[model samples]
Target: MRRIGFLGCGKIGKALVRHIAEREDMAVEFIQDPGFINDIGVQCPVLAKADEAAFAGADLIVECATAQVLSENLELILAHCDLMMFSVTAFGDPDFERRAKALCGTYGRTIFIPHGAILGLDGIFDGGPVWRQVTVETVKSPSSLGRQDNRRSVVYEGPTREACVHFPRNVNVHAAVALAGIGFDRTISRIISDPEVSTNAHRISLSGDGISITLDISSYAAGAVTGAYTPYSACGSLDRALGNGAGLRFV
Candidate 1:
């Protein structure tokens, strides 16, 4: 069985553990969460520290924690095992991405980025040497916006790199689009807060090589918290990763 280590025990990490536990080919061996060590119980090894020993026997480490956790634990994780990061938005930091890539090369391991909450990637990659333009509009209820309540508003619009830097918490979708199409600087993103919309919506459009594609997806809040649907969609990407010839490609 393929041994896996998880770097967070939040909704997505818990979902991944549940998913892997049911699979015949993979088993979660280690779980790390600073916030909730006892929540998952003895079903798996739980650790408070991020270190090679914590990840000792795992074949792969999945990071579903915040970008801060990722930035701090990354070197240790990469040193011990191959890594799959759900927080791809952190890569928008050019310095961090460059250093991480170099470290991965030095450690002779691979880093995988899940699609998370973006679409039309296959089409974008299919058309190589392509130029991509994207606009991301998010519609969420006032409660979903947290403490500050606005009736409806456009919060941000700019290059994906800047958006990722300014809104690290919301970078997954934008980062996914940026990595899949052009680099972060080339991808356009817009964030909107709409009280009228009950669900989260993502719309993507790409035109290149005589092909134009558009994808619009709306997902209801799966759990009590906001941003629940993104991780559920990320689960789909994980499924694709484990399937043969099922990996996503533009072509």
Candidate 2:
């Protein structure tokens, strides 16, 4: 069985922990969540810090933490073990991609990126020298947008690199698009807030040589109190990508 270490206990992390706990092929050996150390409360072995030492005996470290955690803990995670990151938006950082790749090379560890909320990625890399572009239109309720609550609004539209800076929370799709197609600067992204939409809707359009594809996904908030995306839905794509032996294509 594969021994897994989790770096967060948020919606996605908790879901992954439950999923792994039920699996015969994998075991969650350690969980790290500084904010909720007491809240997790004997669910599994918990760690206080996000560091290589904390993850030292695990086969794979899965990061379901926030973007900030990705930025801070990425190096430690990479140095200690194989890593699969769900916070794909962190790749949008100017030096993140370069540094991550370098660490992977230096430590001889694999870094996996799971396709969080983008689509048409399998078809994006079907051909040669593929010059691709992506545009994301996220329509979410004002409550989801936070602060802006009055009317439907276009929150942002620009290169993925710039968009990541403005909307870190929503950049996973953009980062996934950038990594799958070209790079962050080349990929386009847009965010919209619509009060009429009760669910978080993500629409992605990809155009390249001889092909233009689009995907529309509407994800409802899971728990009533938290109002976050369903962990199963976000992590489902990751499970598929990992289980199918597809290398970071969907991530």
Candidate 3:
């Protein structure tokens, strides 16, 4: 059984905890959430600070927390165990990204970034150096975009790095797309606020050597800033990490 440690207990974290709790091959060792004082019904210890000593025994440390959580404990967490990152937008900072990658290499720990709220990643990744350009356009309601806009508007238009900074909570899909295809700088990210749209929609367009591909996915809202499909993606990523032997993996 894999002993898992949680770095956050928000929507995605809570969902992952519940999913892992039901599995026979995994156990939630400890959870680090500042607001969580009570058990919260999970059979695990909750800590205010996700220190290295607390997660020393964990087989994998899943970070469903913010980019700040990742930045603050980069060395400590990597020194402890492998990391499953949800806030992948943190890598937008070149310095931070380089440091984190170095730490993972030095510590012999893997950092896994899930395909959160997007599609066609396998194809995009496989497309390789041939990928000339990739663009991700995300449409969401104003409320979900974490702002108040009365009419349809383009909230942001720039590289994935800047987009992640402006809309960290909303545009992780862009970060995932950036990582899967061309890097943060070359990858374009556009965020639209449309009052007409009830569900969150993501469109990824890629132009490569011999192929031009586009994929559109719409996810119903579970929260103002989150979709119902995100938790399942996170769980699927975890399942692959845990492994089930010789089965064909789906990227």
TM-score ranking, high to low: 3, 1, 2
- Model 3, TM vs. native: 0.94
Expressed as tens digits, the lDDT of each residue in 1-251 for candidate 3 is 88999888787888888888788889999988887644458878888896667779898888887898878988888898988989988988888889998998899999988887876677777785888988999999988987778899998988999998898888888888888778999999999998888888998989977888889999888336778788888888888877744668785
lDDT of each: 0.72, 0.70, 0.84
lDDT of candidate model 1 versus the reference: 0.72
TM-score of every candidate: 0.86, 0.85, 0.94
After superposing candidate 2 on the true structure, give the runs of residues whose Cα lies further than 4 Å from its correct spot: 37-42, 222-230, 233-251
lDDT of 1 by residue, 8-106 (tens): 777778777777766778888888886765554438767787567767788888888778788888888888788888877788988879979999999
Model 3, global lDDT: 0.84
Clashing pairs in 3: none
Worst window of 10 by summed lDDT in candidate 3: 35-44
Clashing pairs in 2: 114-251, 115-251
The residue-level lDDT of candidate 1 at 12 comes to: 79
- Clash count list over all predictions: 2, 2, 0
